[model samples]
Target: MIVEGKVVKLGDKIDTDVIIPAKHLKYTDPSYLAQHVLEPLDPEFHKKAAEGVIIVAGRLFGTGSSREQAAIALKAAGVKAIIAESFARIFFRNAINNGLPVLACREVTAYVHDGDEVAVDLRSGEVLVKNRGVSIKCGRLPELILNILLRGGLVEYLKSAVN
Candidate 1:
């Protein structure tokens, strides 16, 4: 999959609570949850995400609780993909399981900036900064993970296979 969108930059060690604060956990609706996503970090994150964006975050993105809601909120809010220096293991898997693509590029934070247009090629693991004319390499998505994302998450992928 190839995803292109404006960047939404965030710092390191952003935990699940910051992604979707605990106060909003009562809601199961993805759209409703999205409205409060990253509220602690940026009050206008929902507005920016609604316009479609690619989140570029520093090391250890998604470092806390393994709530699937974090990924759901982001995907529902129109985050095409996330490029981070590193990711917490559970969050990484949860992202893919929710049909949200995530990439890790150690050099990504050094080159990309907030609001810059970028294109991410999951198959090739290439991130192109459209405004800067720069390319960064990220870890490639394995075929299994790609399959899950292509079918719009694990449940859908399994349903299709069983059908």
Candidate 2:
């Protein structure tokens, strides 16, 4: 699978609370959660994210809280993928479970600037920063996880499997 989008750059240790504030946790609906997604970190994120953006962040992105809603909110808000130097374990799993592709590329954060176009190839684990003409290597997702994302998350993947 391949995903392409404009980049939304972020810094280190962006925790779950910053991804979706605790106060907004009352809403379970994906669209509702999306409205408040990253509101604390970037007030204009929702507007910019609505057009399908890819997040590029520094190390330990998604460092606090294990709430799956954080991933759901990002996906609903139109975040195509996230390329970070590193990720908190739970957040990485939650993101994949929700069909939000997250890649860890040690050098991606340095070359990716906000609004730059990026294309990620899941099969090859290559992240291309279009404007800069740069390509960074990332770990490829295992086939099972890739299939889950291709089906739009675990639930959808299971549904197809049962058929």
Candidate 3:
């Protein structure tokens, strides 16, 4: 899958709590949860994300609790993909399970600025910074993960298999 979006830059160690604070977990509605995403870090994050973005961040992005809500909220908020130096293992899986494309490209954050347009080829692990005419390589998603994302998450993939 290939995703293109404007960048939404964030720093290292952005935790699940900041992704979707606990106070808002009471509501399972994704749109509602999306309204508060990264509230602690950036009050306008949800607004920016709503415009469709590719989050570029430093190491340990998603380094907190194991709530899948974090991934859900991001996807619902219109985060097309995420490129970080590294990601918490659980969050990585959750993102794929929720059909949110995420890649770990250490060079991405430094090269791409907020609002810069980028195109990501998940199958090739290539991130193309449109404004700079640069391409950075990240670890390619395995075929299984790619398949899941293509089908729009795990549940949809599984359902298709059973048919």
Model 1 pairs in collision = none
Task: Summarize candidate 3's per-residue lDDT along 23-87 as a digit string, tens digits.
Answer: 88777788888888888988888888888999999999899898988999999999999999999
> How would you encode candidate 1's per-residue C-alpha lDDT over 1-163 as one tens digit per residue?
7899999899999999999988888777998988888889887888989988999999999999978899999999899999999999999999999999999899999999998999999999999999989998888888998888888899898788899
CA lDDT of every candidate: 0.91, 0.90, 0.90
Which lDDT value does model 1 have at 93?
Answer: 91
Off by over 4 Å in 1: 161-163
Per-residue lDDT over 84-112 for candidate 2, one digit per residue giving the tens place of the 0 to 100 score:
99999999888998889999888887778
lDDT at residue 98 of model 1 (Cα atoms): 93
Please name the candidate that would achieve the greatest TM-score relative to the true structure: 1
Model 1 — TM-score against the truth?
Answer: 0.95
Error of 3 at 93 (Å): 0.8
What stretches of model 2 exceed 4 Å from their correct place?
160-163
